[model samples]
Target: MSIQILNLNPCYDHWVIISKPPKTPNVLRGDYVVKLVDGKGLNIARVFNTLGFKDYICINILGGDVGKIIHAKCKEDGINTLEFWIEDESRINTAVVYEYEKRMLMVNEPGPVMQRKEVENFLEFFSSVLKENGTLVVSGSAPRGFGIKDMARIARFAKEKSCRLMIDISGEWLKELLNFEPEMVKVNADELRIALDLQQMNLGELLHIKDSYNIKVLCVTYGKDGSVTLLDNRAIRVKPRVIQSDYSVGSGDSFFAGYLYYEALNKSIQERLIFATACGTANTLKYGAAIFDLQDLESQLSNVDIMEEEL
Candidate 1:
């Protein structure tokens, strides 16, 4: 299957490993440092590549020196990218992972702003590259000068081109994309609540919303609690295998990648959830985002449990 991952805003991600959080007036030292081109779409692409799927391409808008660095790093990592270059500098984000703790502190920069013409040019480029019966996975937030209407237009055009749509985004962007009726929707529990403006999430409400949107597969990830999914007219609750780790930066993206990989192979939903949950949990086994050993992923598979859930 033809597959493409979309990330509207790309960035240079820097990671530092330290013993603990810094205190005021302290001279701290990092134990290790790693840097890469990262975004939700890129993370998904990385995981897919790790899983031996290398035919997909990552699509994003990048700019300035930081964008140049991002492009170079992605090339080093062997990630195929279709970039829309802009004058505004791309973003740089940092994450501090702790050695003693299972948590990380992250600071992210808002991405560059695009002019009206740039947006139009990007849409035209996206339209030119779209393939019939391809799969388009839209992930991450949009940059400045991009709005929900612009995002919806992409979805509309993808449908017009007979592409299967899957999304991993939230807030107003997600709320708007629902009208386009994507085939698969993945979001965390909090994002789902916020996007739909729900006070609480339950099976009945999930069913109502999914039916209303005609969404075929709705997956709500609950972090360490696993995920609750509505698929094939059934509710499935997945309980992930807990491993020894505190870092979970790109687990969601890994999960999305895993699901798409298995789906492309025509795996059953039961099989897909097991692999997806395993992949997500596997990402926490390391400090870097979406970096996991195939052995680790395999080890996690048998431990993941799937059960039929009821309201």
Candidate 2:
């Protein structure tokens, strides 16, 4: 199956592993650390690779020295990447994790602005690559100077191309996409709350949105409580077999990627959702984001409980 991924806002994710905290306020060196090209797009790509799916094509906007590193890393991973170069330096996002302390602190940078020519270039490339029966995943946040109209245009183009679209974004970026009715939407509870302007994720409202927009599937994730996937007439909940996690990042992306894997196989909704939950739980067992071996995932497959939830 062909899946095209767009990471409009990419970043060099610098991870600082906290080993020993200083007794007093003083400088303490990290035990071990690493940097990875991240943001939802890249994370999904990583999971896809872990699962041995190599057909995904990623289109990302990169710039500056960090962008160079991102490109080199993607190449090293053997992923098919198309880089759109910009003038501004790409952003650096840091994640400090104190696993023993069960504490994690993340500092994120706003991404660079995309020029008019850059937007046109991306559109041209996207149009050239999109084909019938393919999946287009527009993920991550819009960069600085990116407007809602630009996002709407991309969704419209995907719709016109007759490619199935999956949305994993929030707020105004998502508000604009709703007009075009993507085939599937993956939003966490917080994202759903913000996108729908509600204090809670009301299942009825989610169903209404699906019916009103002609969306086929809407998935909302709740951190430890599992997730609910809503269809036109029914809703299903997929619960993880194991809840313990060390790495705090990439579970959502792993779930989405896993779901995409099953979707590509034309699996039933229940199998897709169950396998997605299994992937997320297996990912948590690994230290890094979206990192899981087949052994870990296969072991967890028996634990995921899929049940029908009343909408």
Which candidate leads the pack in TM-score?
1
Worst 10 residues of 1 by lDDT: 20-29
On residues 56-100, what C-alpha lDDT tens digit does candidate 2 reach at each position?
988888888988988998899776788878888888898887766
The sequence of per-residue lDDT tens digits that candidate 1 reaches over residues 55-105 is 799997999999999999888988988888988999999997767776678
TM-score of each: 0.96, 0.94
Q: How many residue pairs clash in each candidate at the backbone level?
A: 0, 0
C-alpha local distance difference test of each model: 0.89, 0.83
Candidate 2 lDDT trough over 10 residues, lowest sum: 21-30
Please report the TM-score between candidate 1 and the true structure. 0.96
After superposition, candidate 1 runs with Cα above 4 Å error: 20-24, 309-311
lDDT of 1 at 274: 93
Clashing pairs in 2: none
**lDDT of candidate 1 at residue 256, scale 0 to 100:** 91
The segments of candidate 2 whose C-alpha lies over 4 angstroms from its true place after superposition are: 309-311
